[model samples]
Each structure stands twice: as C-alpha cells, then as structure tokens.
Target: MLYSMSFPLSHNDKNKYRYSHHNGDSTCKGIDVHEIFMTKSRVRLLLSHIGILVCLVNCYISLVKDKLCSSSIWKITVIILFAKFMQYKPVKKESLVILPEFGLQLETHYWSGKIARRFVPGGKILRPVLNECVTPFTCYWSLALILHGEDQLMLVFQELKPPLKLLVPIWKALRSSFDVKEGSSA
Candidate 1:
C-alpha cells in the first residue's frame, strides 16, 4: 500500500448506487452499468413528463390567481404518472386524502406510499430516489410541501382537489420525521 503500488477499481456490485461514481458524491452511489447511461427508476423514469406537467400546472395556477381572487392547485400528475409508470396501475384520481396532522399519504388497493422527502441539515445530499414497495432511497418523500398555516392549506386544496388531499399527511409525516415545527415551512 505505497505510492509505488497500484490499485484496481472494479464494479463487482450490481447495485446502481455502487457501480457509477460521481466525484465522491453519494448521489451517484448507485450507478449500474445499464443504469449509468439511463436510469429508469420509478421516480426518474418519467421526470421529463412530470416536469412539463408541473410547469403547466404552475403557469395555469399563476394565471388564474392573477386574474381571480385565488385558485386551487394540484400535482396529481406526479402520482398518476408515478403510479402508471412505476406501479403499473391506475391511480384513484379522487381518493387522495389529507390529514393536516399527518401530512400526505397515498393509499389504495394497488399501492400505498407517501409524498415526502426527509430533510438533511447540510453537507452533500444525493439525488432524490423514487420509492416503490421495497426499496426507498434517501430523501424518499422529497416532494412534500410545508404549508405555513391552515388557511394556506385550505386555499391550495380548493384549486386542486385530487392529490393535494394527500399533501397534508405527507407533509405532516415528513415534518414529524424531520423534527420540523408545526407552523414552520421549507
């Protein structure tokens, strides 16, 4: 183990997190040979479509809120797309439930999960990972939004009825897990 000696680095691991390395970053911990080029995980598989949908929703909500008193906003597409591509099933468009104390929770016959992302105080944070049944990576529920007040939550729920219903529970759970204050927000 001297400067004169050499070493060999081999990807004997099948884990996508272990195969590819991104400059000492944990985000690239799992990068399989096949996955390195194009990672098709549940979360990232359809990010392109999700990003577009998020943008469109934001634009629509902004326009409506500008002209009107206020508007409801929902990101059901995130879960629907998540379920369709990741879960291989149709998500219940109307069954989203919100528990202010609990944050947001996605529950159904086919699958159940939360729209959450655990918080990290500082340091290097890895890329977000999509959560399925078995494997949940770091910051699993990274999409949960923290509402400052109850009125804010109600107003949001008004515009978008489907998925925001669950945002509360997801946020609550995440907050509890991360030791966030009840009235605090991200």
Candidate 2:
C-alpha cells in the first residue's frame, strides 16, 4: 500500500505552514500514522527478506520430493503473499473470554471434576430418560473440552458417561429421524 500524508491548510497560508496526517484510504485506514512513518533499521528488513527466501527454498525442495512442484509452488506462493498482506493489515483483537460456556458449571457436580459427588450412581439410574438431553450436551462438552486444550485421555473419559455409552443405538435412530424430517421439509 502507498503511504500518503495529507495536510489540512488554509488557502491563505497554504505554503506558510505545513501539517502532516494520515491520508485515510480503503487499505490503510486502520493503521496508526506514527507506526507507518516509524523508521526501522536496514538490517531488520534484510533479515526478514532472507527468512522468507529460506522458507521458500525449503518449500521448493519438499515439493520436488513429492513430485508436486508446480501445484506446491503455487500454494506456497499464495501463502507467502497472504502472510505479507496480513502483516501489512491492521486488525482488531479477538477475546477468548467471549466463548460460550454452555452452562457447564451449573448442570452436574460430576462435570466440574468434583470427585466427592455421588453422580455415577445417579447417572446409571437416570440413563434412559437423560440420554436425549445428555447426548447433545455430552457431545457439546467433549467438543468444548477439546477446544479448551484438554488432553485426549480426558476427552475420552469425559465422553464415557453412562447415558452416552448405553444410548449409541438410540442416538443413531434419532439422527436418522432428523434426516428423514429434513428430507420431508425440503
């Protein structure tokens, strides 16, 4: 993107005083004027260029070994261009705290990793009626656990609920019913 600084001056004293500020364009609108004008050492720019060249060389060598040099080259080129474009672009930060908690803490004491709770016996007795409500929530929890960086073993154990384990056939039947309903609606 081109950098152009606009100066707002009165017609009477256009040449007498000069002011420099951002020339807000479609691409550079969000960038701070100070950051764009800040000077960097020549060595930094040279090192960045060398780093990109090294990555490209590695990609090319890997592509040649795979016998997909042409397609891989195109993909790598696009990826590099995209990275450059994003580096130049200013973006707003996203918040991790905004993720939906989905009533995880409120539902059952066992879910919160509380060991003292007698949830297992209750779960075994409540398996039949609770399967419908539990399956969707169980699936949702397993997915959320994965998203929250839990280990694979924890994810497996968390999903091994009495209802979820016993009601696999019932869940499949429900899924088929939904597909039939969707077909009819369409």
Candidate 2: RMSD over Cα atoms?
A: 25.3
| Top candidate (lDDT) | 2
lDDT of 2: 0.31
Estimated TM-score per prediction? 0.18, 0.22
The residue-by-residue lDDT of candidate 1 on 92-119, one tens digit each, is 1212232323333332221233222222
Each model's lDDT: 0.30, 0.31
**Pairs clashing within candidate 2:** none
Best by TM-score: 2
* Runs of candidate 2 exceeding 4 Å displacement: 1-36, 69-186
Kindly provide the TM-score of model 2 when superposed on the true structure, using C-alpha atoms.
0.22
Worst 10 residues of 2 by lDDT: 90-99
